[model samples]
Target: MTEQQETPPTGVSKALQKDIPQATVARLATYLRVLAVLADEAVAIVSSEELAVAAGVGSAKLRKDLSFLGPNGVRGVGYDVIKLRDRIEDVLGLSEGHRVVLVGAGHLGRALVGYGGFRRRGFAMVGLFDNDPAVIGTSVTGLIVRDVAELTDAVAALEPTIAVITVPDAAAQGVCDLLVAAGLQCVLSFSALALEAPATVEVRRVDLAVEMQLLSFERARNAESAAEEAMSAAAGALLPRVSMTTSKGAVVQP
Candidate 1:
């Protein structure tokens, strides 16, 4: 068989493509957030220790993640906050703006549309949709909430590659199906439902209740760990240990 022709990646595909680990990819966004704070505070040259603490990671792991984008750090002097931030943004494809549409103009959807971070982080909210007639034609965050019935047309007109589904669990799957059919390759769903999509599409579920439960679990674990440590310390102190030798290596008991 003759060698098959290699198709070139489209601009958007190129932006989305990266060889980094999913873990690193997740951390990169967090790092970018930390970096943005540093930049805003006019702080230059952040040490690995400082950056890692801010990003909730180890300094060594942070360095490794940065290395995936090639060498962007200066030895000894740490990383230049602004330059590193730019590099990270480019790697995460935040350097280019992404057109995003919100489906399910309920409370969750409305809140997300009003969130300025979406625009600040390079995601442009192009449209909002809902199936409820009461919400349709209503203005939200300066944009009118269109009926979900218009999703197909909106997708054709707006060409959104990303969609956010904040519909209820009962409606999430259908909304997701519509989104995928309408050619949205990436989706973020706030519903509690487990969404199924084609292999070509990516679906991320963000259940607020689940997240809150996870937070509660973590807090409980932390509290238990702290209590265990305190108990151990108290037990150790009460053991009545005999004092030994000092710097002179002489044996003594107190």
Candidate 2:
């Protein structure tokens, strides 16, 4: 995958005008999602510690992430949920309501369209496309699946902010090229292969297998560490205790 340049969006605050770290940007998304849940539950204010726990991050880390957007929470009262949510939304460009076009109406694509969270999160589903004859012309979650040939035309008409590619690994690059040629500036791909695109176009790949492998590695490492600690404790328990005897002693023990 190509490295993405850290360029701030236009019209952002001076603090945000400077490039935000990619890792921090990812954490901001998590914070935004947590804040959305808080908003739905009618939470007015949440302490930094509470938000950090909810988002699975350290309190200091959460505060530092929010700092990139400038001052957020009141020191005494905690963060105002709605205010913080809006600030994160603005910084992450969610306020713009991005329109999305997804190709590959297979299982993954179908599931993605059926997801209501996308619309709730301000991502509009503009089009769905696939090359399979059986899948074409079918409706998935109110959006008709168009043929791959119609991709460029649909992209032209829909003007999607992002295109999603979930086609098979073999067809992934071809689909990516079509989307790029259709003038799409951003793409989110679920295909296993790393897609090739010009630097001007941003492509993000999500490989489920790689993620699962990472989880497996962490689990194995933790298990190994636990076993080593157990062995160390057992060895300490087996150590002989030191004993002392006095001159006239009937057996003295220490």
Candidate 3:
């Protein structure tokens, strides 16, 4: 959604993509998110360079990534923000709203239900389910929690294309089994454990703890790096900050 800054100097032929690489496909999702933000901010045309910067990718790589969408952006004038966004939507199958159902009303489940991101991204949370009697009739984020035993029936009736699993590790497989049989083709699993689904079904696992641990590792690396830099600086400070070179320079410290 960002405005175009500068035009490309050379004329270019229309780019083509027979099949997008998985890496590029992954990056396109990120691009879509950035485009949405830019569109919300009222950005119109965005040069490849600008979009790349915003998306944390190289300009050439971003341009190549977008080429998979086919002739969406003009080489010189840049891309029309809305047009590019729509193209990505078409590619991602987000042009149509996808119905979703939540399984498990645990803490993580409750959070996913309340999250507005799915709705914002053309995914609608149509139903909520949990097994516990205490939570069965309770409402989280305006949807009444139905008993998990009703999942198969609920899926048949609700016809949700996406099923979200936030149950504990012990229950994830059971929940997954129900979802596959209930005719849901896609699942978003938040449990720490991996759930095995049929080859026909697609399951996207999101382990929050693993992600946090990765961040922790990164932080530790950065701290170690900083400590190394500080030690180097402290050692350097013990020596001369500047040095002078005579006519026949001995590289003498001034």
Candidate 4:
């Protein structure tokens, strides 16, 4: 059994949800993960500084983010790990498991189906689908890949919370439209192409190429900054230093 800990009631006010910055929202997920590890370790209470360090953030920023969820931390004791974790889960809509269906069942789709992280993160993969006749009926990670033609019918039967599209770029928009028509409210697409959907639907793209490009840009910028600093240091070393008198009247070269 884990260590006994005081757990506060878990709930988030609608006002708390309102006007939360996206950056804070993103960091909440990170905090939740850190809290999960702490909870699993049976850690009862976690100080703000400790939790912040574990979550790769500063204590001030972490406290500010938690402020949106209301004051739960004790003055001297810090936060109740389980309670804080539960509250963050509620805020991010992770308290309830999200059922997911992946379309395409290609190489990437198969790889994703095999990944265990999604299931661990409360996302249930209910179905795997593809348009290819040969791909259909094949079992990938225990899920039998169904024909894309059955997508609408499957959506009605399974009632997935999110649809993951891993189809090719050319077919991405069409697949997105089909998912929208089938009444999926949330979509996670890995296609490089941009998809069009109604404002009511939430579409998130995971373009690996674009992410790589961004990393490349940062790498180049860091290299340039390093070079500029090196040049500045070299130039400063070349410049002759002026003699200065100290408060004690001793001469010093600065």
Model 1 ranges with Cα > 4 A deviation: 1-19, 41-44, 237-254
After superposing candidate 2, which stretches have Cα over 4 Å from the reference?
1-18, 237-254
lDDT, candidates in the order shown: 0.79, 0.83, 0.78, 0.83
For model 3, what is the alpha-carbon lDDT of residue 60? 82
Q: Candidate 1: TM-score?
A: 0.80
How many clashes in each structure? 0, 0, 0, 0
Whole-model lDDT, model 4? 0.83
The digit string of per-residue lDDT tens for model 4 on 48-138 reads 9999888777788888889888767998799999989888888888889899999999889988888887887788899999999888998
User: What is candidate 2's lDDT per residue for 166-221, written digit by digit as tens?
Assistant: 89999999999999999999999998788999999999998788867766766676
Candidate 3 lDDT over 69-184, as tens digits, reads: 65567768888888788778777767777999998898888888888888888889999988899999988988999988888888888999889998888989999998998888
Task: Provide the lDDT at 218 for model 3.
Answer: 60
Model 4, which residues run further than 4 Å from truth?
1-12, 237-254
Error of 1 at 11 (Å): 14
What are the clashing pairs of model 3? Answer: none
Model 1: per-residue lDDT, tens digit, 39-140? 889999899989988776778888887776665677888999988887777777677779999998877888899999888788999999998888899999
TM-scores of the models, in the order given: 0.80, 0.85, 0.78, 0.85
- Model 3 scores worst on lDDT over the 10 consecutive residues at 245-254
